[model samples]
Target: MGYIILSIPVFFLLIGAELLWSAWTHRKVYTFPDLIANIGCGIGSQVVGAFTKAAIFGVYLWTYDHLRVFTLPANVLIWVITFLLVDLGYYWFHRLSHEVNFLWAAHIVHHQSEEYNLSVALRQSWWQGLFSFWFYLPIAVLGVHPVVILTVGALNTLYQFWIHTRAIGRMGWLEHVFNTPSHHRVHHGSDPKYLDRNHAGSLIIWDKLFGTFQPEEEEPVYGITTPLRSWDPVWANFHYWADLVALARRCTALGDKVRVFLKPPGWRPADLGGRERPKEHDRTNYLKYSTDAGANARRYVLVQFFLLLAVTSLFLFKQDSLPIWGAWVLAGIIVLWVMGLGLVLEGRRGALTLEAVRVLLFTGAGIAVWMSVLGWSWWCAVIIFLGAASMIHLTALSGEGEVAGQ
Candidate 1:
């Protein structure tokens, strides 16, 4: 519940920081659309994680139900030690999530955003929880209660959130001891030197002890080496999967195909090949193209930022009471918004229509929230329906933005 409560505010904080940085630097870059995408990623990942873990734990408890093997610990010191052990367990799991290729597939979604901010922290993987619990089973075997493990895990995750930003520079001596923003920034960096470095959670000692530590030099470059080409959540999550599959198909030798898939993004098969690959760049060049979506999409995202904020406000209000239907409505609106944003970013002519449709849909969300506050009936749903229909019509009639200084 604390995680859910803080998620929205954390998002806004990140947005505020991004805006301030842009203003200070005299650049107009906006990361609000990226924030919306991250919100989807975070909630989606947790929901998928919860269901997967529930099933796995159900089987574990059911199998152990008859063993008479468990007793909840009563001592306070032992519980504290157990919690610390859990953090240590997470240290290893988090480390492996970056080191192992198979695990990295799920972990990569969080690093997809080119801009590093609190929103990047929220960008999570839908598939991470499916396999991540295996790393924690040792705790269960050691007789630590699952409740204690969960509490520690939540704390470990919460502690890492503050480290995702450019607002705070290195923390002098604390840089050597704690997982500061500088250390985590290096972790997110695609700089050849920074790749696979600083893989710690809640403690920086692991990286120092493990020989993977690297201090932030000249402001770390964020995002994966190969930037994601689309804004769609499904594409964002599975783009690497698709890339792997295509690489596998291109390789005639099974071993080569498997190897290519596991190797870093730029690998290629020797005998069977495709077009010439693009040249790789020094990590320093990353920021140049970090938020460079096409023109139409930028406009669409600008509107989306405003519109989604309205929808998000409503979602927050009804979050506790309207879990089932409200979730779907919010999800549907978000999906369409991403689609529209992508189309505009790609310079599609139909984006004008999408823009119109989105405005109506957003207006409907606003009206629905207002009605709910005023104690209205199901007629409120009609606003969303009409808004959705208007969105479709708007998509059909929209055009390109007028040139500046006309």
Candidate 2:
């Protein structure tokens, strides 16, 4: 977690560089709303992970203490071996997430974005850490320290972040060895041929060996086959599960109902619809999911998002010292912040009302923090000023129809 927090600056720098490169080349790969959704998912994942880590790590530690076959020393050679093993574990875990139904419920969030870029790399599923840790328990059993596995896993994750871009072309031989952007783009591709292919984490060797590899020939059409069609980050994470449960409810047989989760994605009982695979769509005709928002709304959302990002950053940095209840309170506020931004971006009917409420909540929080921490502070003044200005803008926009900025 510390490693990831430290890399935040680098992530922003590379994302900025990618934006510049895209503009300079006239090959735009990002949309404003999609980018916001991506970052929102990323922030949500980190906050959720912070709350879940202790329990997840506890399981790993228990497995290591009781189920170990042999303990390995923390040597350089062991580190190299553990890294490979962790990557291998990620390979299987990632593959299963796509092939299995329940797992896809968490992973689908990562593939919800229609555009692939550095921001897409940050788009992670908030619940994945809860289930994914089970896949790496074998390493703990093998006597590798849980901390070592965790650190190596973080490095594996950081390595994959750069591969989530179109700016970099295929590296000749490196593409054959490592998971480069070309390979990752294919993985994210919604085209039938690319579906469920290239499930490597940091190494392309797993894909090559396991026969999930596909070369990028035609340009890939990015996103899931059934588009999420909304910007709500929380809904993006849970919608698939809701769909699965609904399907199960429609089934009459107990076994079929159970299979709704056990079977691969797109599978259904014959009574429900049978297995209907997603057909490939023509790349030239592909359209991204979008919603119209006025200039004012867009500006408002961006400012609110950045402010929430700052609050989230502080929460992450001070999580150890903060009380558990306080941490959850902060997390709830951030979640509402993201949801309000999403609603505003989508130009939902009550978006202005939601944003107005969010502004009041933030203003109250600022006052509480100021009164509790210092008698008076410049930070409180800034928060209150921003909140007041946002409320005014939201009020003005309330007269606009469901679609703002349009």
Candidate 3:
């Protein structure tokens, strides 16, 4: 989480650069609602991780303490081995996330966006940390210190962020060895030939060695075969699990119910239908998920999103010093703030009402948090000003149009 918090500035800088590139090139790669959803998911993931990450890492700590066969030194050679091992683990973990049903429930959020850009890379699942830690436990057991594994892992993750772009073309020779933007774009692609291909983290050689590599030839359609069709970040993270549960409940046989979760995604019982395959769609005819929003509504959502981003950054920076309950309280507010912004952007019924309530709640909670520190008065003033402006915007928009129902 510290790695991510420290990288937030860099993330925004790169995202800004990409936005400028898209505008200057007239490519129009981003949509406002999609950007909101992407950033919301990223912040939500870190919020959830604040509480759950320690426990997840505790499992690896236990593995290292109890099941160690060799104690490697903290040298460059050991770091290289650790890096390769973690990447290998990520490769298989990533592959299984696409192949297995339960894992895909968490992994699918990253691939939900139809638009491919830097923002899409931030659309991560809130619950992936809960499941993905198990895949890297082997490196810990090999006697590489947990800190080293974490540092190297952060570097590995940071390496992948740049590859999520569409601006960069194929790198001449690096495309063969590393996961370049070209290879990663193919991974995010939903085309028939591109599904479940190129599952690499920092290196692309793993996919080639394991027979899961696919080169980009024709332009690929972006997004899941089944479009999510909504901007709700919370729903994006858990909707697949809800679908799996619904399918399992419909099954009468015990084995079929169990297989609903264990089998690959799109799997269906024989009694219902044989294995479902990826549907082919014309690449040129792809329609992105969107909703109608008045200019003021769009501006409101954009402003609120940045406000929430600032609050989220402060929470991350001060989390260690804050009390447990205080941290959780702030996390809850951030989550609601994110969800409220998504609802506002989606034009869901009663969204304005919800946003109004969220504004008041966040303002009250934020004032309480700031009162304990210096400059509380000025902070309180800023909060009230922002909250008042948001309320005004919502009130103004409420009279102009009806929110479309999802």
Compute each candidate's TM-score over C-alphas: 0.75, 0.96, 0.96
Which 10-residue span in candidate 2 carries the lowest summed lDDT?
A: 397-406
TM-score of 2: 0.96
Per-residue alpha-carbon lDDT of candidate 3 for residues 312-357, written as tens digits (9 for 90 to 100): 8899878887767678778988888888888878888878888888
lDDT of all predictions: 0.65, 0.88, 0.88
Q: For candidate 1, lDDT tens digit of each residue in 120-141? A: 7878888876766666666666
Output the lDDT of residue 133, model 3. 81
In model 1, the runs with Cα more than 4 Å from the true position are 5-7, 21-36, 46-79, 255-287, 290-333, 349-382, 385-397, 400-406
lDDT at position 334, candidate 3:
88
Give the Cα error of residue 10 in candidate 1, in Å.
4.2
Q: Considering lDDT, where higher is better, how would the candidates rank from best to worst?
A: 2, 3, 1
**Model 2 clashing residue pairs (backbone):** 294-404, 294-405
**Backbone clashes under 3 angstroms, per model:** 7, 2, 0
List pairs with backbone clashes in candidate 3: none
